[model samples]
Target chain A: MEEREISKAVIKRLPRYYRYLGELMENGVERISSGELSSRMSVTASQIRQDLNNFGGFGQQGYGYNVKYLYEEIGKILGLDKKHNMIIIGGGNLGQALANYVDFEKRGFYIKGIFDVNPVLKGLSVRGIPIHMLDDLESFIRDEQIQIAALTLPKSKAEEMTALLVKYGIKAIWNFAHIDLDVPSDVLVENVHLSESLMQLSYNITRYEKEHPRS
Target chain B: MEEREISKAVIKRLPRYYRYLGELMENGVERISSGELSSRMSVTASQIRQDLNNFGGFGQQGYGYNVKYLYEEIGKILGLDKKHNMIIIGGGNLGQALANYVDFEKRGFYIKGIFDVNPVLKGLSVRGIPIHMLDDLESFIRDEQIQIAALTLPKSKAEEMTALLVKYGIKAIWNFAHIDLDVPSDVLVENVHLSESLMQLSYNITRYEKEHPRS
Candidate 1:
């Protein structure tokens, strides 16, 4: 499919489809109809069919979809079938948490190293990925052919580190920094703003209170 | 405005607007036209006007918006102006990371306690918030009037813990567990699927490669 044909909404929902199908596969479900999958996913059957059709329909009209087959196909489309080397650029609490995250490898992201300027964290390791000095980041990225850099740095350091990573030829960034980074249009960034999400929860709670006032 | 009137899409974007306006305020940007704000935000001026209009338009005909006033208005709409006491359940890596996170307090969610099933983790303190035994979760929530529960537990524990939290009167859950929680309609949950996002970055990288092939 051409890039223009695929909408941002569709691309965003691709991961949700990938996740739900993964669960079904793990549960040993062999097949599922669009309607059944839709019920499980909280999306409409037609919408589900439409999304899958964008990448060539994996579902059969009568036989439904082979769960494993569909999962693999979606995984392939998501580039999850091959390993992508990654590095965490900060060794702070959040960065250390991510370094210890076990699911990234299972989803085909191999964290090659963790980097920090702090002297105390230099020799430490989390889940076998040793913390390397920030000085080595450029050489490491080039040497390992690292494709993604996970920035867990402070807001003050985010822009500089992002530019450094882009300069060293990293193509994508999973940013956990509080601030946004300005990058060329070619570089992909997925900003995970924890505060924004917490605020959403705050809004929901407030809305609920206003709707269902205490009697 | 009534709960029925506002769309979820608008609710989701409130934090983004809040964040952007905040940056402008910090930079000493006193006032901004929708067109200028739109340029900085990468959103159209009409869309910005529409979003702000939901809560009664804050901008004037020619003067545009006062950055501080707009920021404060958005904060009020998002319920970020009031303090919401919270607890972090499951004192694991992710939970600990969040417990140490300073931004939540700055944003109005004050984490009062951390709970864990592990005996070793119990009685430990992170950022001065003690990790209490999981058994005390019920009483702690009641005593603290905790409005939010940040769940960073393993998937196996999510459902049971969610039920417990709801029973103890948790209004919202910020779930980091890989699995979806079964909650009542009134109980709000915002699932943060880390791997799904990583997959998105992977897909983007692949798309970039397809678009700009190495010669």
Candidate 2:
């Protein structure tokens, strides 16, 4: 299939559209107009039409978009149609929480294993996924053909683990660590900087207060 | 202080600058030229100078920017210098993990309480923060003067909980639920949409594979 480059902003919105469409599918909705989808979401009807038009314009002349078809297509575009083996590089609360999320599995990203430096947690399991010692990381990734690794380790250990993951041939990283990781251009890293989000909230609150002073 | 309008893009970059400058401070780096900082970060030197220039351009003509002073100024701009009282709505693993994270407190975001609909989880403490029943959320918010609420609840309950939270006067929300919330114009919400981030990783990995096909 011939593919054209999609803008980053449009790529960012794909997952959101997939999510809403998934919800609609769950509710047994068969089809939806751009106007209806727009009403359901924050995106404007014209914006929805424009974004979808980038992917060959799914909607018919008057008959709206087929919800399931749109949802599946978006999921495929996101590479969610294929199964991806994943491992958690930390067994801390955050890592375990991610392992227990259960949503990732539904999206075809399976948590094949969990690794940690702590000896005590090595034998434990989260949601039946066994935790392994850091010593086992190399063999496990190789054997499982793990493509994506989630880094939930501390700031002090993030860079070291990142280097190790790269060396072991991991292609993608979902980093929760505070520090940035230096990786090869071919490798992908998506950072979930919780503190940064908090800072954004703080900035918004400050701006709001400045605009609306109490009498 | 005279405050000029800052763009959304600039606001997004503030946290990153804050993080990088913090690392410089920790490494005992006293000052850094824009060129040197550019080499360390992905951003270009001219872009760094332009971004900083938005806030009165702190860099000296020839010397450099004082790392500690720049960090402090960015932190103040991000509103990290002031304390924010926060409550997590949900006593699940995600909520517990957020409560256990010590970094938020260091950045002046305190998780004062955790609330859950599960009676079994009530009275349990995560990092010494007490877990209360959902029924007590209203009183807790009022009594503690809570400024921020973190929603780690399931999507099914997110909207109802958001309504209650808004009614109870939460100024800012860190939403983890897989649903977009409707809030008053004055209220602020920062969504940590993990699925969206994962999809982004998936898309990147797919693009990489397509570009560098194994011979």
Candidate 3:
């Protein structure tokens, strides 16, 4: 088993594992070893072994990870064990979608609030969550105990707002702003550049089609 | 140099390399070999070499890679060199924010249109791109040669919409759905699961704080 100081890369891999495991559970898959997971996810068995080791060695020599147990542990380590209070910083469509995101609650996270700098959205309610002003971040974070703040502000505003959120003691940020966030070393900043992901997909699909012709 | 049939995984690393290279460039680093870049990005040196090999060998035996050229070549390989007609499907907050995304233009892609099923957003414009109807997708892609799409639809609708887009001859998709997608093996689907990204960030930051503490 590995320590709790998980590698950032390994942590990122958790989502894929979560999704994969969720499907495996959906299909009534009872147990899975690291090798089975590695084959399905296209990651190495040893890599999965190492990643699993961080939380606690769950895999046995002959038997692999218990699919349910591994899934539960991964969820716990990723903070899905307890309901996470989430707030979106921007009240735009991204914020609305995030507010309406069903997987959060299904995985034990809650949308505490969604806020924007725009004065008009202050009183508006989207998906039953009252939109609030940016000024309310500190109070809301403290009162709601928002463990994750989705930063969906504009390009020019990302850095500024991220700093503001950090001041309010937001632990982690899911930044959709296409800007390079300059956050404190202590705060976790995850930038989701949607376009870059698409570009990669396009390039790969083009190449895949060429190789397979008709898959 | 590697063949055009590079693993999607290797191609995905290009943008990160480009981003890191930009940082190194800004810091006035002239040239960097694979070993140096691998260290900075916390990846293996062979990985750096293999990834770069996908876009032609960018390194020299003695000197190293020409930073600017390497970045440019990567941009080209990722289709960042050509002007891409981009559309944001499901004109929600994420779509609106993406329409206003500042980096796309700078990076050589353009948001030509945004469409939503919501009639309220119909004919409305975000950052100058007129929001259209969902029915307009096929026509627009044909007429405008839309090479890419950013789909931020609801999880329930995500797979269906993505399949539709790929069927409509969309070369690539940037999916922001919080669900796993099933795509044709040849079709490219790059998912940016916001929840997953946040989970990784949270656990990794937990690790970073525990290890470095002060840096």
TM-scores for all candidates: the values are 0.96, 0.96, 0.74
State in Å the error of residue A127, model 2: 1.3
Candidate 2 local lDDT, B100-128, one digit each (tens): 88989988998999999898987889989
Backbone clashes in model 3: 7
* Residue-by-residue lDDT tens digits, candidate 1, A87-121: 99988878888887888898899999999999999
Off by over 4 Å in 2: none
Worst 10 residues of 1 chain A by lDDT: A1-10
Order the numbered candidates by TM-score, best leading. Answer: 2, 1, 3
Ranking of all predicted structures according to DockQ, beginning with the best and ending with the worst: 2, 1, 3
Give the range of the ten consecutive residues with the poorest summed lDDT in model 1 chain B: B1-10
Q: Which stretches of candidate 3 lie over 4 Å from their true place?
A: A1-9, A24-67, A202-215, B1-13, B16-71, B112-139, B205-215
> Which candidate number maximizes lDDT?
2
Compared with the true structure, what per-residue lDDT tens digits does model 2 show for residues A1-215?
45898899999999999999999999999999999999999889999999999888889979999999999888888999999999998888888889997899999999999998888896889999999998888999999999999999898899999999999999899999987789998889999998898899999988888789988
Model 3 lDDT per residue over A1-215, tens place: 34544555766788788888888998999888888988888789998888777677778898887888878878767666766678988887668877877677887778888888889787999878999987777888999888788877776688888888888898788887766667777777777876567667656654555567754
Candidate 3, residue A146: lDDT: 87
